[model samples]
Target: MPFRSPYPDVEIPDVTLYDLLFTSLTEEDLERPLTIDGSSGAETSYAELRDQVNAIAGALAARGVGQGDVVALHSPNSPAFVATFHGILRAGGTATTVGAMATGKEIATQLEDSGARLLMTVSPLLDAVREAAALVGLADDKIIVLDGADAFESLTDLIAENRPAPEVSVDPSTDLAVLPYSSGTTGRPKGVMLTHRNLVANVAQAAELLGVRRDDNLLAVLPFYHIYGMTVLLNLAILKRASLVTMPRFDLPEFLRIIQDRRCNFVFIAPPIAVALAKHPLVDEFDLSVVSSVFSGGAPLDGEVGGAVARRLGCSVRQGYGMTEMSPVSQLIPAGRDDIPLASVGVTVPNMECMLQDPATREEIPVPESGVSAPGELCCKGPNVMPGYLNNPEATSLTIDDDGWLHTGDIGTVSAEGVVTLIDRLKELIKYKGYQVAPAELESTLLTHELIADAAVIAGYDTEGEEVPKAFVVLQEGAQLTEQEVMDFVAARVAPYKKVRQVVMIEAIPKSASGKILRKELRGA
Candidate 1:
């Protein structure tokens, strides 16, 4: 009863992630440009990147980081982040990437749970890294700054001192490569164990699906910490031997300027970026004629907005669907394909099976004979799926069934042609500007405020088509607090992206007999 992929299967390379990237490059390709810094106009060639990865790998092995050891990479997207990430994998260690926006406590939690041996970070984020490292009993010597500084051990110095990269054995299928933390179906963040095979398979699947030519130039505005960027944008670009312009952070003007200056041909963006392109006046200030396509993902893109952008830019606008657990890409609209309908996430990638199922009953739903397919929870099965959640067997079992289908918790329908259309999310996590903002995390933060008696968070959309976290609060008796005060309290503690944007005062949060906050009721109100 499952809908199969429309495209023929692709042969996934049976090699480690490190080998998969390096084995395809010819000697001439090694000298080709790899990563270029958008702000500084600096560039790292493929040859240079490979040398740095080798040196860093040797340095990690010399420092006692070996197979199964987790090295925490806590930095914004930069040339060093690329080197350190690959170096960890090459040295038979797993890299646990932490978002730049993570708070000190959040970083500490991941570090503690991951059991990381080394923390690599830029100098600007060293304060948070130091705080988190202290919480988890990490020694000062173990913290390596990617940017060289007089006070701390530097990643460059370590790599330079170790001339020869140490050799290590890795099992592509069993050895952990990257442990990117994700909030599975529910609860606090947990590490998603992605083996070398998983990463390699996803890269292979996306490569054929996206059809990136070797001469293509990519604009990399998305954060490398996120799975979407880490795989599709960064790793995929490298595998295809495409030139990529890297941004430490996204700035509207800077993003546009790089595309114009670098003559980037393709852009991999989120719905928010696409919205800006359609509506922002500054977009007209730069020449974006070189861009041939704009692919949006991480959150749903309004069909009207996508069509508007396509008309304005005179290029193809498409979307893909996946999550952190599915190596983050199960479906994508292949390039140069105009047959798919607007808002469709295109057909499933090669070697992946997708189907819609009743959310409660778990029965597979058949595609309707006429009109759109029935809406149900989308389930996927593929080799690209993660092994499981780190140390959480219950959540893993609940998310991935015995038959290996990963229940995406997204309510959507699949067309007879295998194209998927997403309608709504069954999960409580709010997708604000493409970032997952968990309601539980916000509710816990809100409870810390003495004035708030009870609180519940739900997602709401603004006029711009971006998700906004709206908090409904029950105040203490005779307590007085303005909406701005409530918003400000959360803003100070959490990252800027996760901060509560709107607040509504309520007498009490509606709850069920089992004491669950009825988020739907609050959302309706």
Candidate 2:
């Protein structure tokens, strides 16, 4: 039996995300601050933001950016970045956000895959963005730098053009709004096609589940490029008309200072940040009395860590679970609900159904009677679930079944009250400090080395309790190579987060008859 959401279903507005977010704001509310720059302390009012979004949308239209066109945005969290993202949506175009830290090749791959017609970035990332733009065949004019970089069209120029925003009608349910890449069940990165309705539905669903106070201010330290921040901080904060303090990067001192200065009431974070808040010595130095709750996602939050943070801060500490494909939020701890299980990821949000099924038998698993919960593969069905993956129907079909159920590829258990606790991930991808690192991608890269006969990658924890990708390599007979050499080779090619931190020389890699790596056996070894 599917465990439905305990909360009653909320209404999802049938409109563009921009329309859904702005429709409720009054003229008086426009002058109110919507976002604040954590570094500079600059504020962008709702009215100012809306005007900028309109102007940029007009400029995009003049540049022939029609509906369904993809515009790739590569920048850290900033007020300008926020405007550009919504401007693309305002122009009826899809925004494909790339991580600011991504390498030129990495950005180029996403550019090519998403078929982005334009690239918007900051000057700091210009060198890498330029290389990616060139590799992806994006013309110089099509690449707009946020801060004026010599000769290239700047965001200032676009806003100056001030053409009319294009009027493109869209099917709310089917039209793609944001195309953020996610490594789903299988590890290769693919675009998750989120429709306007999907975003609106999730915002509405979360609004019903979370306790979002109008007076609460949010601390936005998470990267906006990631779905968690994009939805929770950027979109949802705007939906609730909450003031958001944006941080470009996470620094412990700076993070605490902002909380002190801004009196930030709600903090959305990953497990790593939660760990820092729990154990960091500087936490006691700051005045964090105003903070109401700390919410952790992206990775599992240990019960001990959650409890410690709560004890230290004298505030609610909670965890939630979702992937990029689920508009990034399926379950979250309620705003003021202190009674929810410490380690549990909370109940499914409104209008969603979740289930636990035996992986091998494909049978529905019941809640365990032994006090301890029985773990099974977690699956879900909801309006918030993605329509499908972009340009990858095979993966879409595999992930979402004919019955509209999304197989989460995670091992978890649900209580009779609908609370969820994740046990382990069944996917072969490694979670290195909250970033997805595919073992298959690394294995393929390892095979390119002439000295390597075979390779397999698995995740393991270091001394600090952070997940690290550990690679096992079978070298060619008598071929000389050190473990450092293996790690360095992959480090130079891949992103910093995806680099292989540990390597073990192995005689041979165990595999199934069909040539699938037996990762479980290697993990055991």
Candidate 3:
């Protein structure tokens, strides 16, 4: 039997992403500042954003972009990104958001895979964009720069055309709204086809739990290209009528300064930022008294780190769990709920059904009557789940089952109280002498060490040619510790099999834009 969300289900509107977020705006709502550039302190009012969206859509439509067409948006977080994203959807064109840090080959791969007809990017990234555009045989006319570049039309040029957005009939249930590529940490990047309903349903499902109000100013430090930021920070904030202070990239001093300067009340971050907030000395330099809540996602946040942040900032620190395939959020610690354990991802959002099944036996692991259930692959079924992976039915079939359950490829347990605790990725677990050792469990233990600033754990073969837990550690600034000392620390905290058998001190852990450890890169190295 599957466990349903503890919260009451909310009604999801049958409408396009554009209509769901913009249609109900009143005159007063239009006057509100929706997007603020943290770097330059530039602002975009709801009215200006809407007008820009309309003009961009009209320009794209004039270039033959419409239903069933794909347009790639490759840019960092900016006020212009917000308008261009919605503008692509408004034209009934699926927006395929590419990571800003993606290499030319990676960007080209996404452009070719998504069959993107047009490429939208900024001047700073033109070199990579040009390489990608050329590889995909995209003409110069098909490339639009958000900020002006030589020989390329800018966002202002399109908006200045002053054309009205063409009205297009959209079937919210079936029309693909945005196609964000999966992180591709474990495998090749695949386009996750999300419909308008998928995005709208997730926003509605998460509305109450997130509790982002119109008066709140959300710090958009997380990249908007990632689903975590795209849905949670970008879409949800807009739907709630809150303002977003956009940051192009994460810079600790600047991130703290913006929070203090903008008086941003809500902050959405990844585990890496949480580590900085809890441990970085620069954090003490900023007066972040205005921030009321800090939410973390993209990767699992350690309980001890989360607690440290909550105590230091005097704000609620919570964590959520989701993937790009699920519109990015399915479980989150609801706002104002302190009773839920910091280690847990909290109850599932409304309209979601979750289950745990043994990876080897494929037997259902029922929720324990008393304490936490046995760990298994956490599977979810909900309206927010993607219908399938774009152009990859075999891969989709492998991920989502016949009964609609999306196998998350994550190992976790469900408590009798409905709280979900993630263990680790099923494929990332280390097998030592028939025992499964979760790297996340060991990594979390390593983070508690005072000398360790950040860490990542993976499976490595020992002298005996047996798989063992290996740790890549980043020591705190000016701190030094031997490999033996690191191993001994984790050995005392975790089980013998879960101990760090090997330790390699590195300057920093390679991470994705969303802050997930790039284990594949480490493995390749």
Top-scoring candidate (lDDT): 3
lDDT of 1 by residue, 92-148 (tens): 999999988677888999999999988888888878887888788888888898896
- Could you give the C-alpha RMSD of every candidate to the true structure, in order shown? 9.9, 10.3, 0.9
Cα lDDT tens digits for candidate 3, 128-162: 99888788788898899999999999999999998
Measured by TM-score, the strongest candidate is 3
Global lDDT of model 2: 0.83
Rank by TM-score (best first): 3, 1, 2
Backbone clashes under 3 angstroms, per model: 0, 0, 0
| Deviation in Å, model 3, residue 494 alpha carbon | 1.5
lDDT of each: 0.83, 0.83, 0.93
User: Which pairs of residues collide in candidate 1?
Assistant: none
Q: Report the number of backbone clashes for model 2.
A: 0
Question: Which regions of candidate 3 are displaced past 4 Å?
Answer: none
What 10-residue stretch in candidate 3 is worst by lDDT? 516-525
